[model samples]
Target: MLIVSTIGVFIAQGVQWRNHLQRIESRGKLIVAVRESEGIFWANGQEFIGFEKDLIAELERELDMPIQVFAVRDLDDLYGALAAGAVDMALSGTSFGTHDVIASRPYAMTRIGLVHPKTRNIADNPDLESVRTGLLDPLGHQDATKLIDNPPQASAVYDAGRISAELFTLVEMQDLDQVLVDERDFQLQQSVFPDLQFSALDLPARPISVLFNPREDGTLLTQIDEALELFDGSGLLGQMTDRYFGDALEFDYVDNLTFEKHLTARLPTYLSKFKFYADLQGLDWRLLAAQAYQESHLRANARSPTGVRGLMMITLDTAKEMGITDRLDPDQSIKAGARYITTLKNRVPADIPEPDRTWFALASYNVGAGHVEDARKITEKLGDDPDRWIDVRKHLPKLALKDYYPWTRYGYARGAEPVVYVANIRRFYNRIKKEYPQLDEAAEPERLEQLPDIDVPVFPGL
Candidate 1:
């Protein structure tokens, strides 16, 4: 009788587990459990952003179901949530070391980071030999360092405990040259030491995948694999990767250091105007400040070769239009610049989605809306998606080429300048955000502390 009862229970669980997709479909939305509100998944204002969010959206579209995601206080509770059927599945970069759950096909690979002092200006890729002259390779991964013609001698280790910031402090003072650290720690250290340059270690990486209870049906897993294949085969996965990573940009050591120094020195004097105007325009203050830095390095009396002036670098005509007599007045220039950029953003095609739309507007500020449109035409002519900033920026250089410019209505504008301009402003804005995170925004969403723990008695495995 006991044996019969046990077998009967197992049979029932298998039948019910097989209906995982049906359960989710009947519920109207898939309930997703996450460890925290960061990295893989995070909320920015009302809209959610991040690579995992993209994957979640893909999963929803493929399965034809909506998803309502919530986070667990502790990631360890992910197993509990899955076991209790509180959530359909959990998405994480790493599995929590148990055999009770099964992982979907791997979708992404992770890379560690390498950091070092900026001893000299690296125009493009630096000579590893010079940059790594005294860096202590922490993980002892020598394969990446083999790029140097002669291996960099291992330098003295300053025993300031184990944090990346401590070692980076030594690098800042030129006591050491470089060091390798975990990517998470490396990113955390950048805000304090923007002066340091960073690059990814060319090393083997483990693949990351979503996890579900093994008791669940094979059909859901198979569907996930199919969904991933769509992204992989379409090459959209690669494009998305480039969009999400800070490592995608070229490292400019000197420029980052200067931005860092100016943050302490000059930003304070006019910060009130920056914030006040940014708030009025409904823009991120860091973004406005970053644009100003790119224009004039926050100098009140800054003058461009083309006759633009002030911290915001407003042209004479723009200053007059904004009802300001002096283009060099820091207060007037800053306010007008914010309004102008906001106007440019509004002028962009309503169909274009943000952050991309705003980036287009920034490009418009540099060249003009007409030239940006011409670049989009060039991007489309070359068989690329003109709607994406990544695709559009690739063809921006053609606007200056003799072979391409004569054909454009705008004629010969400095096309390469806006490309570099947008890229630099992105880097600067990120640095400022890192240094000064979420300062005045008050309406940020509150993460759930403890989700209601459900109890499912008959479920087997984890």
Candidate 2:
């Protein structure tokens, strides 16, 4: 009798689990956990570029369910939210060994190390002592480095915030002798702070894999694992990693000097045109120049093979749609471009955040608004963040897929082009914002530029 009851209980539990999953599927949306931070893999931003984004997008395509990203304060908070069932699953550059959440196969190998300011060094071998280190919070003491006590120095261990930021801050402020960090974080910091110095002293052990909550149905874990397999095998992950870290863009000192010299000379003359549009749009003129530079290096006669023409590469179709008949006129073109960009913000779903909204608009400008909308529809269907550029941008490429397009409200688009186009624009935007402080105008063009003549471009291509 006892054995029979136990078996009966198992059968009932299976039914309940199956029903729960079916209900979730019927709902057609999945809730996922993510961490909000800078250096990539962040949800809210102008540029959402990273390897993690690639994996999540693939999962959405596979499941054909929309994925919603929910962010918690930090790793500890994320796991706590997971345990509380506040999130269906979580993905970040997080490590395992936290709460015994079921884990998928390791996606990538991340090196853990102690990072310090370039100006400072281990005073002696003993200085390595008293240095506190950690991967994430709970892994806090696991592979942490401590003072040998031979020199007996005091150091405070903090598992606070993203390890990357903490490490960056530590080096930036020369706060600690060293802060534990991953090689990726160190490299990222190095790119931003060339003068700063830091070293990567390896942890005592191997890095751990990311984890998810174990479920009896195993479906969630299975989906995640399969997605990881696909990403790893497809080489997309490797490309993203390489794009961010492998061979970062190198500025040519000589060429840059020449360009700067030219910009200094010509910019003053052209500055009036930019200022004209900036004032009209109530934006900083520098931002208008930045946009022009990104679109065509401020070249008024720039033309692309695709038939995109004019200073801003405004297609003839766009000019007509924007009610501008003159394509070559700089002032009219710039104003039309600004208005068109503004229109994109209004067109994008209200839920999407700023910068990302801008990114989607730019993608639409390069591609078409219909394609962007189609990507968003697909994003909604696939259980991803439709409002998030990181999530929706991934779907942009799929519009070209015949099978994928039929299901979308807007059909058949060359999705891959937008990703590259937006990425390039993002790089250009980031460079200007970083290198030129005076030009920054809340990172918004409308608020910063002053408009004079509204020159709209006429492209031969649709």
| Top candidate (lDDT) | 1
- Which lDDT tens digits does candidate 2 get at residues 1-462? 999999898898884434324544755676666554444464322334445555667678888888765544356766665554555666656434334576678776665555655556554455353554334444422333343122556454555465465556655665555565555555554544444444545443333344555442466667677877786676555545644544234333343444455455655656777767667766545555656766777777888898777677788878988888776788767877877777776787787665567777778877778888888888888887676676776678888998798877767778998787666555444444444445223232111012112211111110
Count of clashing pairs, candidate 2: 40
- Report the lDDT of model 2 for residue 440: 26
Model 1, runs deviating above 4 Å: 1-17, 43-49, 72-86, 94-101, 113-203, 232-240, 246-248, 439-449, 455-462
Full-model lDDT for every candidate: 0.69, 0.59
> How far is each candidate from the true structure, as Cα RMSD in Å?
7.2, 14.7
Clashes of 1: 0
Once model 2 is optimally superposed onto the true structure by TM-score, how far is the C-alpha of residue 460 displaced, in angstroms? 59
Tens-place lDDT digits, model 1, residues 13-70: 8855426666556556677765443345555555656677778888888788877777
Cα RMSD, model 2: 14.7
Q: What TM-score fits each model?
A: 0.74, 0.52
Clashes of each: 0, 40
